[model samples]
Target: MGEQVSKQATIVGMLWTGGTPKAKEVEENMASYFNVLQGFLLYFYGSTVGAGPTLSSNLHQSVMQVVNSSFNLMKDSVSSYGSRSKDQKVAVPVLVGKVWEACSGLKKAPATNIAAIGRAMTQVAVSMKDVLREMRELKPDSGGQEDDQQTSGGVAGDGDGNEDDDDDVGDMGNDLSPEEMKVAELAMEVVSDLLLVIKELIRSITGLLKMEKADTSGSFVDSLEKLLKSSQVIGAQIDELGACLYPPQEVSTMEAALKKISSSLNGIESEVEDLKGSTDTFVKACSGLRGSIKQLELVLSCCSVGQLEEQLTNTSLSH
Candidate 1:
């Protein structure tokens, strides 16, 4: 991995300048170094595959430490790049890729799959939060940019404009600036994707439960449905808000989507509650049946003793 990374670095170096590296070459070198360091850190941190308080606490703390350091480095670099022309946005892609590459190092991590997923989710969340923070510092309360009103092909609200699109429904610490709102919208999109991932996780876990004969006979199935519905509700809201905030028309579509998701979530919540009630009733019925069986055994014992006594008395009389 180190050799491959070094080769990529050499290629990048070659592309940056014709041949002779100068003072400006230091910037590229610095970026590459940071990128490699971040990936290495995540790789090492995520590799530990034990449990208990030893080296296998949740990856949150260790990964977070990497994130904090990475963010600081990126902040300085982005600040330095801010003065460049819009055409110079080529640097943005490299930075974005580096950040994600670092994050991807935490991928396929050991320990537990659930924990791995959680770590991935946390990484995305922290990245979004940092972006929002940067936006706040830049624009203060700049309402937010409008949403995309049309796609390149002319579909309404298809995302042509420079509007920020997000699908996140959870609290973004309030006081959202336009840029922050945009970040929030992107976060929502990330969440929408994450929901699909989570659904897959649930399916895997459910199968595990069945294999272990672990009674998922609880409200688990219904609860899962409810969660999926809620996620849909949130995604729909972000789309609706984005359409409103952006350009192009067709509010009806967004509105209908929101309504459908909301209704589904409400329905699922009700079903989950009913499932709980049913399980409770089934447990009570089993208990009652058990008690009746014990009582019937007692009655049968007494009847047998009475018949035996009568037989003994008759035998004595005959003798």
Candidate 2:
């Protein structure tokens, strides 16, 4: 059973790495034009309705182009992944971000503009640090340092019980040298940046919904609707990530983090929905104000000079 489990893990790892070669090629393409295109899409979205036929068609085309091109580029590169150099492995996180961005339309989503991409790049860095941490956990003892702690009556084993499982050991590959540790530290910085950007996106969408309510009555309804839908998509992605990172037994911390994000998403969702009724109230208020203004204009227009003067004087005296 142990051997079988190890084999299964091996297979899974192979499957994960299988896409790496193509990942590298597509990422190379992304480095040159993806960021620029992302900028244009963001500008266009900010200026136009994300709901219209033209913008929707363009968005769909851009997404499909990126996805199809990336998949085609990655096809020949999968199986020879591990044999690739360290530099190549290091690029994996960035490539992963690009692929996800394309598939999710996160790049064009108002919540995840170019700024968010910058932040995601930072998370990619922390993810790399996680890679190094795994490596350190697998390091061999130098000299007789910290004599290998063994089970009471069993062969001296690494903390993990899988003795002789070379595949498992390699999966824990690489103790961080001092320099590698620095790289990991840098990666953490990136994760922080990414989180901040995501937060900002949430805030931006919330602000837009607020504005929509204030202007053009319920004209902003469709924008709010799209915002809610986009937010839910993001919430789902975050939940997926939380699940992947946390095992059932150790899920509390991950759950807490996810709950915070979900709460923010729900709050914004509620705010957007409230605008449906609020927009109508604003419209009525504006209509009443217009009537009052027209009445004042007529009263002033029909007033005699002395009567208008007396009226102004009376109004001032009342104040």
Candidate 3:
């Protein structure tokens, strides 16, 4: 079974590293790649309890390798097709973002060393952010000459009177204008940053859980409190990122949807705060009960059975 799993993982890795294709092909490849990732994630979830830690760790590393390779392949495709038609150019990065989103389930796998997985995911997020920044930087400048050429080319194509040929030429020349590319790049950056913040939040929460499990002196509580605070901050960041992606003037529906999400996040934050307070109260109550029990045990140790029976009867009468 292990051998078969390894073989399957190897095949998927190959598909990710497959040479750059056109925009549509890139999207298809990414979909297949993420499907394989999802499969491995589910396999790990089912097998983690019985699997050795070393084996699970190795499997995780292999999956991350594929993820990183896929990310790089996406970056290359985006750069290569940056001058392609607006739809094609935009599709590559959007697909990449979706692939990252799909992998968000990795943190939930029941593994012994989730910290390692979280670190790997953080690296992937960082890579994605870098790619977005690169895309923004690659946004082309305004070109009066290019526009003039397009106008002349349109007239020339019409004169040829072959509609099919004209269509082909038009498609080739439909590359995004500078302003449009800038908008697309900015949108992609916001999406990528949102994903990054979410990944970081996941990593921090995983770390917090590990600390809590290993704690004996309640040191983890402070870290847990800090993590909750950080979660609130990240939630706010997500709201800002959403606003950047969907401005109120241009996409009112999206803006309304984002507002709903922001509200939900706020609700979650309040719940986390309430949970923290409840936990502290429970711990203090347990401590007090333990101390009272210890005192009662000391007092009872000095009494014989007859004396204890008399004391109990007197106390009941007084009550």
Taken over the whole model, the C-alpha lDDT of each candidate is 0.42, 0.41, 0.46
Task: Give the winner by lDDT: 2 or 3.
Answer: 3
TM-score of 3: 0.30
Off by over 4 Å in 1: 1-222, 271-319
Among the numbered candidates, top lDDT falls to: 3
Model 1 Cα displacement at 71 (Å)?
33
Per-candidate TM equals: 0.24, 0.24, 0.30
The better-scoring model by lDDT among 1 and 3 is 3
Highest TM-score against the true fold, candidate: 3
Whole-model lDDT, candidate 1? 0.42
Ranking by lDDT: 3, 1, 2
lDDT string, candidate 3, 1-319, tens digits:
2233334334433443444445676567557555665676677567654333433765566556546645654564546553545554445454444444434434444444335434444544565465455444443434588567667877888755344566647445334443334344544544453453445445344534544456566444433434334444434533443333321112333344334434444443443344343244333433443343333233334553345557767988999
